[model samples]
Target chain A: MGDARRALALVRKDLLTERRSKAAFNAMAFFAAMVLFIFSFALGPDAPGMAAGSGQTLLQYLWPGLLWVAIFFTGILALSRSFQVEMESGGMEALRLYPGDKKAIYAGKLAANLIILGAMELILIPVSAILYNIDLIDKLPALLGVVALGSLGFAAVGTFYAALTANLRARDVMLPVLLFPVLVPVIVAAVKATTLVVRGDLMGELWTWIRILGLIDLVLLTVCTLTFEFAIEE
Target chain B: MNHRAQAAGSDTGRRVVVEAREVSKRYARNWALKAVDLRVEGGELVSLLGPNGSGKSTLLRVLTGVTRPTYGSVELFGAPPKTSNGKRQHLGVLPPQSYLYGELTALENLNFAAVMYGLKSHDDELVEALAHVGLEQAADRQVRTFSSGMRKRLALARATLHDPELVLLDEPYGALDVEGIGWVDAFVGELREAGKTLVIATHEIGRALALCDRAVSLRGGRVVYDGPTSSYEGAVSGATDSVRMEAKR
Candidate 1:
């Protein structure tokens, strides 16, 4: 229970700081919007758009993959910035100095990253849907569920790796380098589920993908929490 | 919950609060702390005096378990420093950094720290803590906008907000103004009056020697002199000068 209070305090502190500064959010917003714009321009450069055999354009057919791709890429900023706050403010040593489970720190950081990534997706999804001419209104509920699951899996690992590489001199480059590899299974599960949700679950396999994503999240969350002390150790 | 009346510890008749035996820490090839041994008893105010690379901060870090010793052991309240949070709940630390978020308001910072320390939500208590540090007017101001002295005062409040049995302060007077230094002096005087054990690491030899009873001076990661402050000045100089003369020989 004491650990719970500590975790909640961290979440409040981190979110309040980000809300005031907008450092991570602004950068993520700009980069996410740019990714969507560049991909749209590339798909429709000379022709009307990348046309598939059916009435679908390449942007529509590949919307799920492109959206998750943007999310994963842009999500890196929020995840790394979470721990970067501690690094810049010298709070890492302070965090270690405090006598607690230290896992509380991991949980707090993971929660904050999840919230930041969620907020970004809230904006990115609509913008991408408008740019790509995909109707997400009908699929919003299932799509959101899948998005949440995928993001949980992604953030769980991303937060852990962020702490692991926090003290490195080349952290910005090293964050993605270390994060993306371990995230392969998570990314694959998420993209697959999002793809099923967007195009159609005509074969009734959306649940299978969702189950896989949930399982992956469970595994990642456990491993990350258990070994977190080592990741943040001096 | 009232530890003022509780026994310091059941072991070591005097209740050894902080103990380190043969602790050595190396960063890469350079040893920052070489085979250091120290024992701080309950209610004893000790000054850890040293030069730039003399390892005062390193020893404090080892005692707090911020970094582990490559060799040797450390105990706080008769248990390993890496023990449970229940044991650590009695400890407080103020390192050189403010350990504060610049974007957060002073009040918000204290509130966050209070919750992290597992204290109940008491708005008046936080404001009172701020007021105690002469920061009541700046409660809503962002910490980044604060002067170095203001930040130090706030950090001091944050460190002792939980009212721990042992406090470790590294360079606590580093960025304070004259008035701020006086504030710290008064604060430490009050802590001593209340029988709190404090280990302060600093280069302000004059002020520290005045406030503390014993001085433990370090040179080149070794304890050169550990004795009463009355004899520290002459004894430390004579010892180091002889070592310097031997090196010249």
Candidate 2:
């Protein structure tokens, strides 16, 4: 089979698996929502407390970090799960033996993570806005664009490291440690662009942040594509 | 594709499907396989038999290109096994684990394997394959709900979906019931009729010797015996020290 077709088949299979079992999807979605709820609760659920205690409402300054924090933890949960299913009964080895470019395997996995994590953000983004009383609907398109770009970078690096640690004993703990340091640039870019879009400042330095996110996406995708075959081989 | 390229010599007109010479596979601490030489001809059904930790699965992995040997070499068809996508185009392997997606329905699992095996549309073939394994009624059922025997049957259907020429079966009967064993026997019988090559790794020495043309036994990563299957009884029973002792004679 051609590379594209093979990759599509794998994507279809993985998505179908998630659709049927809802294992990763349910867990990540609940986890994302819980993180948001906890954030709202910890910050006292209103602007008055922040204003009285710190001279500024918590959501006004912390929403961007909180949003990305929710996405980051949720993405880590989903990323760690990407290869865990395949580790069930040697499913990873079977994929490794599939005909054609091994990069297709990585592509399918990265795409699936992007789609799943992106969908999670779709819910979390709006909910995050309401909880923080931030009106983000006006910048929805730009915000989504930044989210997609950032997810691309995060998922690419996350997918690669997820595969790397799939067989290890402490992968749950190791994935975040291995992934977060490498993802500092994407996180910073995403947080910066998100803050800019939330503040309705797309014209000035927002494009630069988006460009940086895109560059991180491109670089991680390229590196992951080139190195996946070697990383997965026995 | 170079997959169909002809090797120089033939095994008396039979195609040499697998060739391994001085193949030694080592891990950090110990050898998994050591100085083992093996050859399998086209249309031959061979049994690789040994006790636990005797490298049966390791050898199967090396042959199917799942694991690379630390030293020596292996060739599948006319080329190295490393060319898995090409050389293993017609290769089917059932590793010790079923290697299936438990979350997927039986039909979906077969469809995934079929696509990977390069069959463009396997809907009809998958139905027929599932029926062959007596899993037609369970086609829409998720594999996690199925019994071990049913899973094995599903694995069998997936492995043979593309009609592979050479099949490597690792513990094909591990979780099988009597009926499951019978189903495997019938499948093997059919493969024999079609003249497909098969390498089976099993601890069921009697059954394997009865079905296979030749028996190759291993102990401690070394070949203990390589001969016609008929002599398996004597070779296994006569030796007092080690199975390797009788094969040396």
Candidate 3:
């Protein structure tokens, strides 16, 4: 119970800090919008599908993958920001001094990252959908489920690696380098599930993809939670 | 050589609360702390005096298990830090830097600490803790707007909010103005009066000598002087430029 309270306190503290500063959020939001805009422009305004003559533009066909790419890239900012705040304020050591299960710190950080990523995704989905000319109103329910699972998986590894590299001098470059490889399985699972949500699952494989994503999230979350203490230690 | 003092006065007969046996800490190629041993009993006030880079902060960090010793051991309540994790509920540490978020209000910072320490969050009590540090008036103001002294005072409040039995304050009086230094002095005196076991690592030689029951001076990461403050007072009053000078052969 104490650990739980500590975790909740951490979440509250992190969110309040982020809300007041808006440093990470603003940068991530702008970057996500720019990624979408650049991709939409590069894909050349919905030209006929190059590889598939299914009467869909290249952007429409690739919307799901492109969206996740943007998310993962911009999402790195949110994940890195999670631990950056601690470093900037010189609070990490002070945080470790607090008595309780160190796992609570991991849990708290993971929760805060999820909330921030969730908010970004909320705005992101609508903006990207309008840009890609895809209808998500009907797909919103299913899409949300896929996004949530993918985000959990993403944030799980993200929070872990963020802490692992928090002390590094080259953390800005290292976060993605270390995170992306470990996140391969999660990325594959998340993108597949999201693709099915965006484009109709003709083979009815959405559940299969969702299940894989869920399992990956579970494993990543477990491993990250258990090993978090080591990463955050001096 | 390690010095073990059976502290006299009221601290006598108290159980040992902190024990560091031949503790040595190495950072890469640098030996920040050499073989050093010290025991702090309950209700005892011990001052760890050292020059810069003499391993005072490193020793405090090792004692608190914030950093591990490269050699030897540190125990709290007669167990290693890992097994004694539960005992840390009664331990409080104030690091050199104020960890208070500049964006958060004073009350909110205390509230965060209360929740982290697993203490019940009572607004009235939180305010009282702030008031104890003369910060109740600044309770709602953002800490970023605070002066260094104000931040240090708030850090003190946050540290003791859990009513910890063993409080380790690193440089408690550093970076403070005269008034702020006096405030810290008053606060430390109160902690001593309340019989709280304390290990303060600082360069405030005079203040430390006056308030501490025992003095353990460190040089080159080794205990150069470990004795009661009364005897050390005589050494200081002698023809010595500084405590470190007397510590020399």
Candidate 4:
């Protein structure tokens, strides 16, 4: 098989595995809901107080931060579980022996991660809307665009970091330790862009954030694809 | 391509499929393989026998283009052991560890490996490979649920799926049971019959003796012995005499 076909096979394998277990998706979605719930309880039912204290308008304010937080934390949870499934069944070594492009391996993994995190975002959006009492109906397309771009960036970085941490000693703590620091620029840009969209602000400001996200995605994807051969080898 | 050029370029030459010229691997502290020169010709079943920390796996990695030698260079199919799009196509490696994805089923693992090798006839080949390893029944079962022996079989299936020209088995039979050993032996015999080159690293000297035509021994990152498996005892005795001489020095 060629690169594209090999990559698709890997993607199918990952998705089928997840479809069988459902553990990864469930854990991420559950964590996203819990985070939203925690924010709701912490802020209480006082809409005016939340609106006043958070600065900008309520709908414009909470949406970006909430979406980012959900994506970030959910991304961490999902990515950590990414190779854990492979390790559990002793399948990683088999994958390394295969003659496919290492980039295809990363792509397949990133695709799976994107799907899981995307599903988490789907759940988190409406939950955040209900919890923060913000009307997100008009901003659906923008929210989705943010989700796509943001998740792409997150998945790119997250997949590489997850592979790095897979065989490390303190993987649980080390994953976030390594991942969060590198992801600061990505999260900042995504959250900022998301805020602009939420507020119905000028597209001009949002384009800058989008560009930053796109750059982040491209750089991380290239670096990860090239370096995965080193990561997977013994 | 003509038959001779194809045979030379192909993984089926009677001459060496792999050649390492003054290959050395070093970290910050010590050298793992020190200026090692070796070759395993096509259709040669060579066993790498060594104790722990003896650089058996490192040498195999260099041969498979997984790890680059620090000092010198090695070649697979007359090309340098660097990651190339085509070099990997002709090589199959079964790492000492089970490098499969446990979340996937045996069939999925085989399918993934087959596709990566650009095996167009993957579906039929996967089925045949699984059956060859006695894994046809467990093909669809998640690898996480597999026993060590089962995982090894799945790995073997993956390695042989594409019918690579050169097969590198690093402790391939480490996890196999009694019957599993027979299965692996049979598989190796089949590969030899097909005229594919084999480089196996194993602690079990008897198994190596049964499968490999020659055995290469390494000690403290150096080649101490290189000869036929039938003369393994003579080789070990010579290795002991050399070590004794080194002690006297």
Q: lDDT at B96 for candidate 2? A: 77
lDDT of 2 by residue, A1-234 (tens): 477777888889889888987888899889988988887788765555333654446765688888899899988988888899888768999987666788888998998988899889988888878877777768889989998888899999999999999988998999999999999999999999988887667469999898889988999999999999887877
CA-lDDT, candidates in order: 0.87, 0.83, 0.88, 0.78
Q: Least lDDT summed over 10 consecutive residues: which range in candidate 4 chain A? A: A51-60
Measured with C-alpha atoms, the lDDT of residue B59 in candidate 4 is: 94
lDDT of 2: 0.83
- Position B67, candidate 4: lDDT: 67
Q: Give DockQ per model, in order.
A: 0.72, 0.69, 0.77, 0.47
lDDT of 3 at B187: 94
lDDT by residue (B1-249, candidate 2, tens digit) is 111112222256888888888889998888889877888899989899889988888998888777899989998897887764676678888777888888888998988887776677657778888998899999999898999999888888877787889988999989898988888988888988988999999998878988898888777787767777886666655432554553365
lDDT of 3 at B226: 79
The better candidate by TM-score, 2 or 3, is 3
Best candidate per lDDT, number? 3
- Residue-pair clashes per prediction, in order, are 0, 0, 0, 16
- The worst-scoring run of ten residues by lDDT in candidate 3 chain A lies at A46-55
Predict model 4's lDDT versus the native. Answer: 0.78
**TM-score of model 1 vs. true structure:** 0.95
Q: How well is each residue in A1-234 modelled by candidate 1, as lDDT tens digits?
A: 989888988998999999999999999999998888888888872343344555677778778888988899999999889989999888998888777798999999999999999999999999889878889999999999999999999999999999999999999999999999999988898898898888888899999989999999999999999999999989
Candidate 2 stretches greater than 4 Å from native: A47-56, B1-10, B236-249
1 or 2, greater by TM-score:
1
